[model samples]
Target: MRKPENESRTKTIKAMYTQIVNELRARILSGELTQGSRIATEYEIAQQYHVSRGTVRQALGELTREGLLERVQGSGTFVRSSVHTHEAETSLPAQKNIGVILSHATDELNMRLLRGIEQAARSRGYQVIFAYSEENDQLLARDIASLQMTTAGLILFPLSNRSIDSTIVRLKQVGFPVVLVDRYLADMDNDYVVSDNVGGGYRATEHLAILGHTRIGFAYSRAGDLRTTSVRDRWEGYRKALYEYQRPFDDSLILADLPTDAEPDTDLFDALIRRPDLPSAIFAVNDWVALEFIKAATRTGVRIPEDVAIVGFDDLSYDEHLSVPLTSIAQQGIAMGMHAATLLINRIEKHVLGEPKHIVLPTQLIVRQSCGARLQVLRAPDEKPS
Candidate 1:
C-alpha cells in the first residue's frame, strides 16, 4: 500500500525538528548562552520555529538527555554548558589547537586565567579546548590520556597534594608539549609557569609577624602529607617566618588537610578560635579559605584586627569587597594565563623549527584592611616585589 499524505507530512515535521535542534545546538556550542544560562521557554521556542509545542519539547528533551539543556521543575529550562566549539575551517588541513586540562570550574581565579588564555589563543588564531578532572587521580589520568589521544599541545593544572603520577611521567616521556601550571610534577622536567607560592606564604606570615602577632597559625588545604610543591613551599614559608620570629615551630599551629579535598577546613577554623589558646593571627592558603576563616571568626565574635588578624593568598576578584577586605598575595592569574598560552603557541610554531621553552612568573602581595592594622606607622607601605 502507498504511504498516506499525513504520514509524509509527519516525516517532514520530524526532520524539521531535527534541523531546529541542530541549529540551536550549534548556537549553544558557539558560546551564545555560554555558562549557567537559561534559554527561552518551550512555548516561545515553538512560536519561534513555527512548530507545535510538542515538537519543541521533543527536540529540547533530546538535547537535555545529551547534556545540552537543563530542565528544572517550575523554573523552566536552561542551556547545558560543558563543550567548546571552534570556528576553524577544517579545509585548512590540521589547524593548530591547544588543550587545557584543569581540576574543575570552581572559582573566579581559574576563570580569569581562562580569559587570559582565550585572549591569547584567539589573537594567535588557535582553537582552545578545555577538560576538567573531578579532582580524582584516576579521572586526571583519564583526561591526560584523552589529551594524548587527540590535541597537539596541552596546558595542565594538575590536581594532587603530594606527588606526581606515573601516568603523567609516561605522557611527558612521549614528547608531549605539556606545559604545567599552578602545580608541579616531580621527577619530570617539562615546561611550566607557576606563581611564587612559597614567597606568598612567607610574605603573608611575615606581615602577621610584623603586626606583633607572636603566635600566628597557618591554615591550608592538605594536612600532614604536604607532597604538593605549592603546599610544601607555603608551609616552608610559614616555618621560615616562625623561625625568624624565634617562635617555636609547633606542628599543632599548622592546620593542614582540610575537611574535604576541594576546599579548606572552615570548621577547624571555628573550633580553633573557640579554643582558649588562640593564635593572635592566621595566614590562609587561598583567598576563598581566608574568607571562610574570616566568616567563622566573625560568627564566633572575634574582632578583626583587634582579637585576630588574617592574611590570605591569591588576591581574588572580590577580595576588596569582602567584609574584612582581604589582605592577600596578588598572583597575576590573567598574566600567567596569557604567558602560558603564548609559550604553548611558540612551541606549536617552533615544532616545525626547534624545541620548546619553560616560563616562570613572579607573585606579589596586596596589602589591604585585614593586615593593615599594624602598618599604621608607615601609613602606605611601598609595593613589595613579587
Candidate 2:
C-alpha cells in the first residue's frame, strides 16, 4: 500500500512550499496554464499538494507579486496575460523552423515521427532542425536549448534518467513553444503526445492470459525503469491484467535490470533454462527486449510457443521477419509526431493560448506466432518447457 500524501509532506514546509512555487511557475511560463487562465482554487491547491489552505494562499501571494498571476475577486486567480506577452516577446518575428530531438535516428521511431512531423511542418512551410541523443550525454539539454535559439519551437523526446534542466525551466518560464513526444515530466505541465502504454500493456498481458498461460513473466532492461513513466505505466497494465485474469502477481516471474549484453551468465538467460516452473509466457518491455529474450530462450533449447510464449511492445518493422514472428503492441509514433509538431507550431504562431494539451494515441496488438495464439502450446503451470 502507498503512503498517504500528508505523510510525505511532513518533510519540510520550505521544501514543499518552494516546490509548489516552482511547479506552478513552470506551468505558467510554459503556456500550460496560459495567459488569463484561471488556476485551481486554494482549497483545490491545498488538496493537491496536501498542504494547508494558508500555505496555498502564501504561494499564490508570492506568484501574484512576481506578476505571473493575479487575483480576480469574484473569479479566483488567473495567470497574467501581460506577463506572458512580456516574457515571451522576442524582438524578431516567429521563425519558420521547428527543432526535433530524438533518442535514436536509425530506427523506425525516427522514420515514423519524422515522416509525421515533416508532413505537418511542410503544410505550414516550416523547416525542421534535427538532433539525436543516443549517448545520453550532458550536452543534450544544451543542444536542445541551442536548437531553440535557431528555431521558433521544439519537439523533444527526453532521456528518461535525466532530470529536468535549468535551461528547460528558463525556456518554459519565457513561454517558449515546445511539445514533448513519447513521454513527459510528471511534475511539470508541458504539452505532450504519447502512446497509451498502460492500455497496450494490459492488452498484451490479457492476450497471453486468453491463450491459457497462467504463469507469465515481464522483462525490463533496468532497475530504474519504474521511475520512467512508459515502463511504469506498462507494468501497471500488466498488474491490472493479472488481476482481471485472476492470475497471481509473482515477483519471481519478473526479470529486471537484465544485462544489456548477449553473453552467458545473464540472469534472464540462465533463469529460463535452469529455473523450475518458469513462466510459460513472457511480456517484454519493448520489441528489442522481446527479441533479446527470444534469442536467450531459444539458445537454451526452449521451443517458441510449443514450450514458452512471448509478447512484446512496439510492433517494430522487422518483427515479422524473425524466425518466430513477434506478437507485439503497436504505438502510433507518426501520429504522435504530427500531433506534437502541429501543437508546437500552433503555439509558436499564437494560434493556441489555452491550457497545455496532453494527447494519448491508442495502441494496437499485432498478433503473430510468438505469443502462442495460433500454436496453442500452453503447458501446465508446473511443467517445464521441453
RMSD of each: 14.5, 20.1
Candidate 1's residue-wise lDDT over 153-268, tens digit each?
Answer: 78888776646667667866776677787767655666777887777788888877776667788877653236777777777888887888776668667766665345545677
Error of 2 at 326 (Å): 0.3
Give candidate 2 misplaced runs (Cα > 4 Å). 1-94, 135-137, 162-165, 261-274, 377-386
Best candidate (score: lDDT): 2
Off by over 4 Å in 1: 1-95, 223-225, 260-267, 351-358, 372-386
Candidate 2, 19-136: lDDT as tens digits: 6776786566445687888999999999998889988899999889767799998989999865432124323334987877777645556557866886798788786666666636
**lDDT of residue 361 for candidate 2:** 96
> Could you estimate the TM-score for every candidate?
0.71, 0.70
Q: How far is candidate 2 from the true structure (C-alpha RMSD, Å)?
A: 20.1
